[model samples]
Target: MGATTVLGLARRAAVGVAGAMGLTWVVRAAWGIPSAMGASVSAIAPVAVASARYRNRQFHNTEPSTQVAPGSAVSLLLSALTRQGVGRPLGAIPLATPEVPERAGALAVTWYGHASVLVEVDGYRILTDPVWSERVSPSPVVGPARLHPAPAPLSELPPVHAIVISHDHYDHLDRETVRELVRSQDAPFVVPIGIGAHLRKWRVPERRIVELDWGASYCLTGTGPGADDLVITCTEARHFSGRGLIRNTTLWASWVIAGPTRRVYFGGDTGYTTAFAAIGATSGPFDLTLLPIGAYDVHWPDVHMNPEEAVRAHADVCGGEPGYGLLVPIHWATFNLAFHGWSEPVQRLVTAAKAAGTTVAVPLPGQRIDVNALSPQVPWWEDVRRQ
Candidate 1:
């Protein structure tokens, strides 16, 4: 073979190798970006900046709050390193097969763990902060994975009248789950301010997205016999939000779901705050209150609620008395998100509720209980705690 012919072949081989390398790099970069990390702050800021929470180019809690206090990283790091089984149950978390009644008259709550719940109020179903994905993270291969299987598949869920999203946190708002629901369900999504951007990014239809600022309410049209329809109000919560490094471009909220006969409150992830009393007075007197009872620590004091705080918030929302409504504890027993013992939240909550003369339901994942049947509380976590 001639030397020039050999050189030509070598040049072609080098070009092919370079082309393949370029293609691989491109694929890696694109694959790293997931819909789990939704819209950027800048992309959604115009809508967010209109709210009272939005100021100085970021959203703020009603009161001055610190999400993570200075120099607390040391304790957090030590806890994360030394804690062995603090974050998960000793035994497998129990599951309940939900038999949703054809129609709920007063109210009923079906808890799906980690802040996901289905509230059947006056014959309409409202789903809250549903996380059906395997893990709550931007990466498919990493992040916090579920400790137990979902009580039931999303496809098995009953027809919902509306889906309420409290915030944009990955654990509450999942990418794959949201995409699947958009394709399968006809229910519109009622979300806090600026969360619609994320839904839009996932190709959810504009007509089906209802975004409300704090203190605003949207009435579900054609869902009631009378003029009074199912009204969902965006209420205050002392928390922050972010899908990426930057935080609080979108508002976080607790919610009020008011049916003709039954009223419910969904306390999304939040720190202890006084907004509960105002919520109670303004749009509450809830028949059932669903609140977070885990993933709380002194380090991040102004975000997640402890069990005691959750009980307090529930009373404050339902009226000054815990007897006003049934309290269903959520945001635990599904993922290992904090340094507390797996059963600690339920244990503490039961004690608190009893002291306050409040009725509490500690349902296992997928347990559906009628709010009016709140007596003889079940200690489902005790088996797991012993195991």
Candidate 2:
């Protein structure tokens, strides 16, 4: 064939490939676009505007907080480029098969990595911030992917009395996860005020969504013994919320799960805030506390807690007694959301907890721990970090 004829064929092939790629991008974007942005502002506004925290058309923290530190954006971008492997584990992050009993324990917790946890209090099970999605972003094609597989499939979870959410962030409030739960479990989604809007948009039954402002509590009644007295409270947290560009249309919060004889605190995601003291005073002296200890950075100190801050926050939530409860660290060792060393959070957390005389359980993802039964500390992450 002549050079011009050969060139024409190559040009046609390139155009065909480009067209196919462009079509794939368009299809993926379309599939994700509807639910990715969550409920529209108007859909969320009515419930949000009535809250005391809502002012100037958005929710605000009791104490002032800047999501990002002023003048640090450029430095943060530069750091992101340079700190590539720091946030990743050197080897496989070990996973555990969760030992979920047929009946919920008096006080137990199953850590499923990141912010997803199953808390059992007085025989009632509560699942918090259950994100089974591989990526914690709006689009599946782009975002921080999970470093470790979810410890267990959502279908394997024992029937929970309630599913609680912390905020409307993609990581915590996953669309696909929610839809799956709706099909598999009949438990209600007890969430912060405006999050119900997103749930509603996703076609969650209104009867199944119980939205509350800070300090509000929902008493969930179940059929079996020790189930009627389970109370899930929406507590305060210093965190921002948004699934899209418009922020804080939904309120973010920590949670208190109080049963007949046991209490558990789920700190969905938050920075250290004084509100914890008030929460402890009114609702705590908890048996167990799940607090975030990852994805924290100096550039956004007001929203995410560091290891030491998590220790302090645990103390604050446990009525100012550092050793009052079992501290189980969440929001770490799953996704690389910040530029810290992969295992730095837990290592620092251990040091801080020991100094504070706090009892902590660092369980492998999917491991279930009975708070009543104490175990020796295991340095599992060390092996992964050393690799």
TM-score of 2: 0.97
Model 2 is weakest, by summed lDDT over 10 consecutive residues, at 220-229
Model 2: per-residue lDDT, tens digit, 202-247? 9999999998999899997767553467888889999999887888
Each prediction's total of clashing residue pairs, residues at least 3 apart in sequence or on different chains, is 0, 0
Tell me the tens digit of each residue's lDDT in model 1 across 1-387.
Answer: 999999999999899999999887667545645566888777798888788778887888888888787889888788879984578777888899877676654588888889999888877789999999888887765678899999999998888989999888889988888888998899999999999889888899999999999989988764445545788899999988888888888888989999888898999888889999999988778888899998888789888889888889988987796488888888988888888888888899999988988888888799888877655766878988899
Question: Against the true structure, whose TM-score is highest?
Answer: 2
How does residue 370 of candidate 1 score in lDDT? 80
Candidate 2 residue spans exceeding 4 A from truth: 1-3, 222-228
